[model samples]
Target: MNIIETNLNFGNLTKRSRTVRAILHHSAGSKASAEDIHRWHLANGWAGAGYHFLVRKDGSVYRLRPEWAVGAHASGSNSDSIGICFEGNFMTESMPTAQKQAGKELVAWVKKKYGFTKVQAHRDVQATGCPGTNFPFAEIANGSTGTVTPTPPTSGNTYTVQKGDTLTAIAKKYNTTVDALAKASGITDPNKIHVGQTIVIKGAAEKPKPTKPNGNTGTNPIIRDGQIHARNFAMPGLGADGIRGPRTKEAGIRVLQQAMNRDYGAGLALDGIWGRKSEKALGRHTVRRGEKQYMVTALQILLMLKGYYCNGVDGHFGAGCEKAVRQYQADHGLTVDGIAGYNTFKSLIQ
Candidate 1:
């Protein structure tokens, strides 16, 4: 499969630690580019576009986010999953043959690269249906298309002559001069052309440019910077100096520990270590709508880190926080009650 590199800037994104599975998704729309999605995600207050790759209907695969970075595509599974989003809503429209075939190849390539045995749909991990019910999850995940190299869009700008077509009429149809068309088609006698003759049009659509590879191996040094670490771990008020120092990471952990202490009254030391005590102290405390607490702030921060919009990490569990909680629950296979209980907290923190 031809993976097209993009120059879209995704300010700071977290690097994923491991690759255990590939998650498939649909754009839920008929037409969109990677850049369009990136803008949408930025509006939602995310790092950038959530999916790592986007497969267009014409079989063009564009790299959106870095393939190795943790994506916002899946809620609980983002840290270890690679997300591949296909263009168009499968629930309403059929996927083109070229797009489907390309998807299979991409899936196969990722599986081979990471030794991945698990390929899942959005609905499999999240509560809501996505990639839609009509998505060909089985066929793509099976990767039966084999190693056939994908054919790029055709290069020739030729037109076929119909029964009543004339050289003058053909040139007009293609918005070109008759002389230019005759020269391009190598027709010395333009008026003497017979039916079913192929005529090349001058100044028609140009050949699509070849895409460049991103040269990413998942270990790029840019993925290790402090800005990404702070954003990945959701450490608000922690300045990311662009340095990948130990203190930056530790400070993020400390923020989480402190939040738990203030909210849950877990009397453990303010150590950055997320050990068994912290886990045990995360009791079955539930926070829902119409409540304001430190736990709500922590919940909002965690939700944002996982790629959900929480309208900023304020200590208020209002409508936005409730909506984010419900989304998180739905995405993580939890009960969708819009409540951040023990199970929700455990999923977000651990």
Candidate 2:
């Protein structure tokens, strides 16, 4: 329940007109850290991490962006809403018990702070599959202050279909049979029920017992030690040791740069040097001549990903890079400045 201040360098904050709603989102990636997300947002030309708060699987809530500033989570709701993102791809995995509790507590905290009543999923505001289907919207919406329990029968006696919901699943949830549901709701085509479709349950079932807490919950390998192990595996010649000395550190970075080029087609030089070219390639910023950074290399890779014919991920902001930028800008209806600025980077990352 403790909120850890990340002290992230978010630069100047943009004042929000008002806070009306709280938006929930998932990272869509497992074992993500606040620093990792901050760097990703920075690469995308955002001032800092997009979410006002980030909750980890271990129930650790990190204050990322300031609550008073406009966030960049939902497309159109940033100005009036607070964004709360949790780690894990809920699309493919159920939220762990700790994360679930933490999310509810965080929502409650936001409610108290902003005096907001509505909590919405990311997909509720946009066309993207963010926050994912497995997100526990009902548990959050009803101000449930405890761990996830079996949802009791609604007083209204109607159930709405959600994404990834199946008739069999609904029947199981309501302690009834699909045939009974079909008969009660006159659902001739049980499979045709779409999201938001209402179906009536004949009668309320007995409340089920609360499930036991999972002992292995919140055990993410990537956050534990897998990332270091993977890095070691990637540079086997470095003895797979987790030491970062001056000699081994640069070599490891070189190996990573090469790996990005080989795996993601980053087109970085095979040289074992962490220069501006490598920085630009990593989506840090657009590089200019006499300035080498990893962001330039990232730009080149993004251009290549979009089918713009960049010669290589060389980390140089040259004529070819400018041309590619201009082409991308024109295609995306951005100002054709032949430079990758905030808008350009946003579009590229998106």
Candidate 3:
């Protein structure tokens, strides 16, 4: 069994191109790897993962859609560019510490690798709240122009969703218009937008879109590769229903922990190693746990002890575990299925 897996095989790499222009930042609603992002784009019907690369919360980087493969990450600009999506949603909040540095490093790497003239945020090119308010997209782009070090987006430039952030108010702050922002985001009503929802104040430049009568708006364009979609991309290697819930997290955590204990001799920390500590330990612990489910059973025990659950420890899952699962599900906005699947496990231990 492989200690680590990669969907991107340079063997089947798409031919290199010189037209790579900009890098777009996006959120996965949580932290994810470039491999995970690649899986997500494939699920979204994209050729591979929409991003050319991905940066994890801990700054780990993985190549997703190769530079030559057309990516569906950006609208009206898939044919001749590279798309980069950092895993966590930067809107409504700050990204994890590791991811923040990782984001900067990845951007710099892409610029050097491709000689991209410009670096733009997903919001800058399209009317959306992607790349979030807190992300330093503008600074990234500006710094790329001449500075050696990356700069942060200007202060007071971020706007947290408030009880009442009227379109007019938002426009005034960014010197933009409500209608333009709404149209870019595909929103029907400005008032209907909710608190904590991210919106782009700096609008995107319109690219030449594929034209057809009532032409496909290409808002959710995905390539059908008979794989999974981002909306359903919680677990891939592990057969699962595509939601990113607690089960997924829990399972993922266990998989990582077992991998760590094998080589390390002693599993110093039982935590899923979602961060740097366990990642290093995993190298020392490379022994496989025989079966995936058995590894998950270990994770279940940890979850129950956290008081996040009261599920009894059992080799086979029981209703006691199921009920605790349901409570955990409800608290974290899961499907409430008694079965402990990918999404359920992820949320449970993460």
Candidate 4:
């Protein structure tokens, strides 16, 4: 497998630290490569890249950290769990072919070496929509959400920009109008995006029904299973029914830690159970400014632009932003919704 891992050590972890389990999957929202993921960790003051290993869409694997070293990727579980970040946003889109191949191989090897019992997506632990929409959650989670298939994608689609890529060039290649591209990508300031920046691309008209599953629907709701199994030449069969079981729930809980971008499970404990802490992180807990630290990223930025504090775009959700959301809802007589619920989010979008 084409993978790279960093050797940096954090506070109490060292080469002696035994990796009990691994949490696999992608950078779901951004278009960053494995190398980019490594760089991002360094830029963010981490000891090094957070994941034990990261696979790029092109099939190149980079190791940001090793199993021996603790990762900062999954909030409360970082100390013990080794994290894996695959390139691409699988939540709302499909992943590259190469990435899918590498993911499986890596997982198999990890399972063999670590004797891991559970493997899953970020959303399995908590209530956040992460790992992206295109993730094959059932295959990875060991089951499906229900018998029902998910909603189909609409005609307008979004795409994140890649390195050495351009909007106009992509527009031309896709045979689409720049206006449609801009709107679909939700680029109010199209000119502001940078290398490795993602944008929406108007794809062929979406089908009326959910597309046939082809490895994108795994235990993680956002990150696809195809990429997760790409590590080895021989990918294991996940089974036909593809329904979620106990294993899938476990993965969601792990991902929940990352989705919430939590340092420690404030309202919850580190145990595998998904309860109040997960709910609060899912934006169900009470809101109070100067209490929550808002993490800055596209999601947080979008929330802030819509008048939520999001603590000045730092990429970590702080208490201030949570307070702002509650205050805004109360002022608007919108049920005093402390959480950034769908309705509140829609209002912010408006």
Candidate 5:
């Protein structure tokens, strides 16, 4: 969450009158630094580095434009929105964990500082598919992406560099590598550790996967009971054979249709078909935790189809359902708030 100041000067910049939301975007190309962006934007005959902040692939945040200045990133919303750009093209590439984590922290910090909750993709206000389809918008927007493991106690996990203690010796004592220690401690030179410098001693932690009902640790499978529940939603082609397969996965549409009919008073028949009626009936209802409704059932079914099981396809948004939703969101690059809303529904159903 550190914002690195830049010495690059811009020609002409206007101070913004208000700040509303954060508009997220990707550079649409790989390997560009803040200086590069500033030069490119200057070449575009405008202010330097149209974005307010540029987050690098190595989790470094650089201040591109002054926070109070209006940016030229977005179309018409530049006057009221702060633009934050990432350093990679998200359309064809997945974001690195460090970059994603840094983006999440930057977005959360900006939201807290500006007292705003609205986080929009570049395409949300423009006609282009910006920020890319592969960007983890949901996780970053909701600030739901987390560290793999809890940070250990400082006394146990950190070491104060003694006058005679070398990084190799400290790493050996901590059972880690010099490279990992250097990366964690932001040490540029392995041979450079002065006295009184405290270094964190930990390895890279991997994200934990949700445990399935069958005691597996990888992708959660759609249980036969989920298929059975889908069959109850009047899903055609399901023979109630207690077997989960492709047909069972497709039956999620029926679950959504049934939920809409029961919960939203949509007059469509529960034929388990995705059509105009189902699409139109899906209002802007964002379902989150602490709710007991048919929409939750639909969300559970959709998630289960995607190999993320939520304990059961029950109409409850409990911890399991939330976790499943977050995992699904992380996979699909959606907002990771564990809430099923218009975008989540569209991504699931469509």
Candidate 6:
């Protein structure tokens, strides 16, 4: 649940708007990072990366655009919703387990923070197969509730090992003892199993009794040794699809204004409009070879926080700053372009 904050400065501040729903999108590309997506958006004449957050394949979360600023994601709904994009083309590949878990956790956090009651795929609002059909909507929706019903084990007698799996962990997941599992699998050493190795489990024909809704059947839900599953009680207004659309949008302009004033001391009036004074106070300038600005100072601070040594947090984007930016981008799997454009700015700020 570690969130890296990229303090991205949108040069031209769009009027603060309220968010009423959370939209899910797939990168539609393979193995790209948040910085890569940000660069692409900039090339398209966008302020920066459109999504408020980006979830990496390994379940790491990176903040792209701030929630208060209007995003450039969904065409007409950008002003009234938050966008979250996952890294991968779901049309041809299933979401990896880590990514799925991270996505669900992020969606749940957004719902709690913004009081958003609706969740939809990109195609649900527009006409495109962005978040492909292979996207597990049901599983993600169910995950938002903070509980998941474990699927019953298959009738097969053998299980293949996956990455990061071990005999002890697998045995615990299947509700069996490690010694028994090793004995059944004919392994001379319990720790000798390798990835993709098939291990046999005894009693392949025995099925655990089913549990009744009221717990009156005397049988409990099958529990894996170290896994926990809790029954999900239905909540009012949330349908079986786990969406409650058409909620009223709350006025959040004041929230944004207050935050700006406190953080940057933008000297803006309490008025919520994105007027000339407010825009000037929150103006963003590009940091390059000879540029100097308070925004660059902020970027330096963030870069240092991310463990990239930038020499000093001065208001200048010089050779040192450029070197730090390049290193950060490379470490995060972004293209090694050294200019502090939209993508670089977003990553540095976060």
| lDDT per residue (tens digit) for residues 70-171 in model 6 | 888889888888899999999998999878987887787676566677888889889999788888876765467443211111223357778888988877
Q: Lowest lDDT 10-mer window, candidate 5?
A: 147-156
Residue 324 of candidate 3: its Cα lDDT? 54
lDDT of 3 by residue, 1-350 (tens): 00011346332344333455765776547766655665665676656666666666654455565444666766876667777776777776666765565566556645664566677777767778888877767555544332222111111112334787786676655445678656543345678665543454322113323434773332111111101221122224432332223554444565545533643454545443465665454332111122244433544443442333333333345544544555455334565344555565545456
Model 2 over residues 191-305: C-alpha lDDT tens digits? 8665645565522223322333753221222112322332342334443222223434444455447545754577877565767776666564344443445556655654543
**How much is the lDDT of residue 131 in candidate 1?**
94
Q: What value of lDDT does candidate 6 attain over all alpha carbons?
A: 0.59
TM-score winner between 4 and 5, please give it: 5
Off by over 4 Å in 2: 146-350
**Each model's C-alpha lDDT?**
0.69, 0.64, 0.49, 0.48, 0.73, 0.59
How do the residues 1-350 of candidate 1 rate in per-residue lDDT, one tens digit apiece? 55555678887887577888999999997898988999999998999999998999987678788765799988999999999999999998888998998799888877766677899999999997799888888999997564532211111235666799998887765555788766655455678775535665423213311223863221212212333544544444554342224555455455566667887778767666778887777766788888898777767656643445666666899977876676566445566577898888777654
TM-score of each: 0.44, 0.42, 0.37, 0.37, 0.44, 0.43
Question: Best candidate, lDDT-wise?
Answer: 5
Give candidate 5 regions above 4 Å deviation.
144-350
Q: Is candidate 1 or candidate 5 better by lDDT?
A: 5
lDDT of 3 at 224: 14
Error of 2 at 50 (Å): 0.7
RMSD (Cα, Å) of model 1: 19.6
Query: For every model in order, what is the number of clashing pairs?
Result: 1, 17, 40, 89, 5, 5
Query: Which 10-residue window of candidate 4 scores lowest in summed lDDT?
Result: 146-155
Estimate the overall C-alpha local distance difference test score of candidate 4: 0.48
Model 3 deviation from the true structure expressed as Cα RMSD, one decimal place: 20.1
